[model samples]
Target: MTKKIENHPIEDVFGDEICEGDTYFVFGNETVLQSNLKQYLIEKQQVQCYEAI
Candidate 1:
């Protein structure tokens, strides 16, 4: 017999803050990509890193 596995909702664990904005660079492989993208966005948008708030 197979047993059912229970999974918790992400919001339940992370809370409502998870839904507020975009979150990048959570993965190791995506580090370089995130850095490059962040730089590009900063340049193209001419915005400061703190401006993301």
Candidate 2:
């Protein structure tokens, strides 16, 4: 099975409930990193991290 990030902005999913100081978790395999939105959230926003199992 393939897991991917939604091709939309985080606000689309979380609505206005999410804020800069709040932390949220997105679950997916390493492939999720391939997504531009996900990559930007991790790299540019510095809100996500990767862990190898």
Candidate 3:
């Protein structure tokens, strides 16, 4: 609720818009992470990803 919005202008804002990044993460090592988990199990779903925290 933005703390009831009293004097809520530039209070060290970190949520009102300052996002300049996208996210994607798949690691490698053990033979390329087992070949990308066998290409994500030959087809997988469920993706809505974001991370800057």
Candidate 4:
């Protein structure tokens, strides 16, 4: 005999992005924002280090 697996609700699986910061973290993984890049450079003062990471 074979057993079947159940799936969780979509909301439970995906969670939620209830604020701007939450949304940013969710989508930011796939794309680099220009302002974030600039701020990183200004804070680090080294482009090579950022690129290496």
Candidate 5:
């Protein structure tokens, strides 16, 4: 399953009422986060992405 947030501006992706400083918790194996170059997203957006086991 996949969801795409396309055709949206940066503000819409992370600003209030959207991401709103929320943490995107990944409920999967370590490889799940690593597979999609997701780490780069941290540096890219300056937000936190936590993974749960």
Candidate 6:
């Protein structure tokens, strides 16, 4: 899971903010891609998440 840095706005390709930890997850095979990362940020920690189109 990623954390947001204050005042250092995070944005998508179109310049729209991607809430939650300002992050998104896709099907990958990397060690850092934990299955619960997205869910944890939203459900467990209750962060405002957005999906990138």
Candidate of highest TM-score: 6
Q: Which parts of model 4 have CA positions greater than 4 angstroms off? A: 1-34, 46-53
Q: Give the per-residue Cα lDDT of candidate 5 at 35.
A: 31
List per-prediction Cα lDDT, in the order shown.
0.37, 0.43, 0.29, 0.33, 0.38, 0.47
Candidate 4: count of backbone clashes, pairs at least 3 residues apart or interchain: 0
- Give the per-residue lDDT of model 1 (tens digit) for 1-53: 33232431233212222222333233332222232456645755476777554
Best of the candidates, lDDT: 6
* Residue 16 lDDT (model 3): 30
Q: TM-score of the candidate numbered 5? A: 0.25
Model 6, position 40, has a per-residue lDDT of: 50
lDDT sort, best first: 6, 2, 5, 1, 4, 3
State the weakest 10-residue window (summed lDDT) of model 6: 25-34
Candidate 3 positional error at 50, Å? 21
Candidate 2 lDDT tens digits, 1-41 = 44333442344232334333343444452112232456557
Per-candidate TM-scores read 0.25, 0.26, 0.17, 0.20, 0.25, 0.32
Pick the winner on lDDT between candidates 1 and 6. Answer: 6
Flag the better candidate by TM-score, 5 or 6.
6
Clashing pairs in 1: none
Q: Model 3: per-residue lDDT, tens digit, 1-53?
A: 11232332231111232122322123341111222444443444344445598
- Model 6 quality (TM-score): 0.32
Model with the higher lDDT, candidate 1 or 4: 1
lDDT of 1: 0.37
Question: Could you tell which candidate, 4 or 6, scores higher by TM-score?
Answer: 6
Where does model 2 exceed 4 Å of error?
1-34
lDDT of 4 by residue, 1-53 (tens): 32232431222112332333221111333322333545444554465543553
